[model samples]
Target: MSSSYQALKPARPDLDSAGLPYSPDYGDIYHAAQGSLAQARHVFLAGNSLPGRWAGRERFVVCETGFGLGGNFLALWQAWRADPSRCRRLHVVSLEAHPFTREGLLAMWRASLAPELQDLAAQLHAQWPDPLPGLHRLEFEGGALTLTLGFGQALELAPRLEARVDAYFFDGFSPARNPEMWSPHLFRRLARMAAPDATLATWCSAGHVRRAMEDAGFLVERKPGLHGKRHMVAGVRRTLRTPGKARLPQAHGGPRTALVIGGGPAGAGMAHALALRGWQVTVVDPMAVRDGGVHQGHTAAACVPLIARDDNPRARLARAGNLRTWARWSALAGDAAPLRCGALQMQRLEGRAGDPRDALAALDFPADWVRWMEQDEASECAGLHLSQGGVYFASGMLVRPPQLLGALLAFPGIRHVQASVAALRHGTDGWQAQDAAGQVLAVGAVLIMTSAVASWPLLQQTGLPADAAPRLATVQATGGAIASWPSGRLAGGPSCVLGAEGYVLPALAGRCVLGSTYEEDKTTWTQTARRLAIAEKMPAMLADAGLATTDGAEDWWGGDWAGWRALVPGRLPVLGPVPQLPDAWVATAFGSRGFSWAALAGDVVAASLEGEPLPLERDLLEAIRP
Candidate 1:
């Protein structure tokens, strides 16, 4: 509609000579429109029949056209929070041609905000993207609710989205004023996003819109409108495949059953990715109880490349990995693996100096989203006191690796076994993954993602050098280190996450985690003693940055943090199809950056296995291949 965009703007709705809202707290736009509460209930809540339709469903997806002021989103969230019968997951896909600024969006949220909604609003404000095209995913409610905001014209984005909607809110402006929104082209795209029998409701009952909907294969109807309106248009998708009846079987290419020898992040992540692409996957790991067996309780890592200001393979992969991982984790919300925090990588000297930051400054990284924080701001933003300069990473967070692995294990087509894999044999048909008891666990395309220690035996016999290990010490001659402790002072810590001598997480499960040591070519149980020693040295580290305080210290939360060897060569993880074996692949060597790169690696592997378009650049994928 011509006026549809205006309706979303903070301007008077009914005024003939429209007056832009002066000093409009973005929140007031909704307040003025039948008041924010009523607008949400009538326009968004009722328009989609949310709470009622979501009852008893495992997952509910709602497609929104306007997303004005996010009032409808807030209302739907409130309803979901209040409803006991709501779906287990809520996915909201919204299209906005012109998005409001983060500051403006927060102001809008404050007008009619509840505590939970306020928290979500704050997150949205924090992660709001620049007005760029493509999808910007925002996760909330521990990943239970996901909002995929497509920042482009509805017609352009509708074709790229992959979702089946349960309901739709056609909240565009009046058809007479905003006819572009009511075009037949958009209606066709809407039809594509809807599942069979998907319901849709709109405040407008204009003849042209009804005709357009009918032409697009919806059974249109006219229902009583809200308030003084005579009628509202509602419709159901008439063109779509019915569930179960139209489901396609997994694509089998010679080898059908696949085997994974490890149940940790690398193996489990590969299993999940392959299963998503319609492969039957079996994961074998002896220590695989539930959740974290050998790899439990480890803090999450962020994907930050060791790139100077300019764009390099490291920077490109890190950027893509960051966005993809954020989206994947958001979709798997409420699964045992939940990403509770974000990460920020800051520079020691603040502004550009001699190294990477200079290259970074050249790319003009999104200043609005990722900006340069001066020393004072960086120190205050990060709870850790700092005296030196550095770039402040605002979205960094320590992740829960066990939780993430658990989520990957739950994929429908993937099966988990607790047997220790003893060997892998490659034959003409495919590969056979066997356990110590010689029981054949699986036969098909195989992916080896076992960690550095486990990988040596498997690769050594295959003529691959012992240097083909997952441990970083092979290349850098250093072992890894980490420690966790209990502390409450970090609860209300700074906004920007900081990393330097050793990274620190405020706390999860009531204790803060700190440490990590780097030793050269050491693969023993020396990590704990080193962590204890570092724990003693932490005060000096924090004191060096002017953050020494007794209140931030406490007993160790998870005992002495141990050291583990990473298989990475130059810190970058190895990914993609394994070069040695024809149908075999590998997802390993993530080092300290496992959390950030794992999900992206999974995606790349899945796409390669399925022969789908690679989501990442080809060169980047080639560099990480085994």
Candidate 2:
């Protein structure tokens, strides 16, 4: 499938005289006029035999074509909550071409929803995702229920989705008005995602829709609709199409114990994600922090997505990963909590699409995600003068690497072992980490190599085949540094991160962190402590603003921390199984945005190992797979 696609158009839901929402573009009602809740219970729930089909199962997945107002999802969730035999995990993946604003959903649902489901509706509204294109995962009831919303065209999204759906809810607009919603290609894609003996239900009993389902390998039947007002459509998956094609790998189930081979952002992230899933994780690193100490002597970094005029894979990946990180970590507390002060990414050089404003205008990205700001406005937002205009990211954050690392590792069930593994070896226990003298550091049924560039040597020692995944041998250890100055200096610094060539971070502990400089030198970052790196040329933009000068001030302290980033061929993070090694995984090759993407990478590994619904889409997971 082609990666290029247009941005999503905002949903425009209109309330009719009876306070029912209808699509103005398609000129169709959102649901049957009898009542959305009643229709959902009859057409979607009862028609699919849901609560009973999902009973006694470990996990159940449901996919809906159109999320409309999420009435069907709310109904399904409410029923699941009330069922004593409900599955351990309920995953709902829904596609929406144009999702209504959160406020619109709140107002419409509050005024019209049944009182029993009002609380769930409010929770759904509170967690409604920004209409950025691609998948957005929302967790409720402490991860027991997850909703993965695909905010884009179904035809473009269904084929790229990754799931083994147990039940399908066809709830889009009428086929006559929205033919694309009932296209053969869409049904084929849905069939491809169906689990064994999966069931489907839809209120629309159109003949074409039934034929499309039959052509896509479903056994169709007519079902009674709510109050017998009309007939509803039902389907059972008899055989899926596209036989002998490559399919998404099911989770590699094994013992719940895992051994992680690093203690930095990537490794700690994996440890925490697995820990939350009730897995016992042992993290092996030579630079492990002591008990109650968050500082493994790492530097501070900014977690802001870069802007590309074309919105390439890099841009989209960064946006998704950065958003995922914020969703996972913004709730952390205490003195070391991440600074959610946002960021000001100044425009550097001229682009094919002019500058930041033009790029944003062409993309039509949600302003809540990012907004183009003029120089004066940018200066005002940053609490300082700027040399040029650029994009302002209100979701930008400053993360202290060591603190984040510590907090992640501090989660229950994640045991930290202060030892380095010179190589890896698999034995009866599954995967084992060993030191230079052949001493074992840790062992587990599954292993995640997040040991940065050191993982390449470890993989080589384990005798990986010559024809391993493409680009496995291409990881490079690129070194860099960030200098820190007192926040009182640089005019108290900007209230947020200021990025151009080199970025500046908001102060923590009276010191502000400047951005990094890349080079090819290696360092004893793991074997030693209190390692600080020397930053490169300061941005002239800051100098012009008189925020800080390039004349080299000796007052800068906080020991500019030096570190190395694992860079892959395409400069994206590589995660997932190690080609032929089913029990082993690797999450490395995160370039400069290591901290930004680490959290999402962790969730991906966790979900994959637990046989749960994937937190990322198939195409994206493939793009970053090792």
Best by TM-score: 2
Regions more than 4 Å wrong, model 2 = 1-3, 240-249, 290-295, 349-354, 522-537, 543-545
Candidate 2 residue lDDT tens string, 253-347: 67899999888778877888898888999988877552323234555778998767777678878988888887788777663466778888875
In TM-score terms, candidate 1 sits at 0.57
Judged by whole-model lDDT over C-alpha atoms, candidate 1 comes out at: 0.60
Q: Could you tell me the lDDT of residue 11 within candidate 1?
A: 25
Native-referenced Cα lDDT, model 2 = 0.79
**Stretch of 10 with least lDDT, candidate 1:** 1-10
Candidate 2: Cα lDDT at 209: 88
Every candidate's lDDT: 0.60, 0.79
Error of 2 at 39 (Å): 1.1
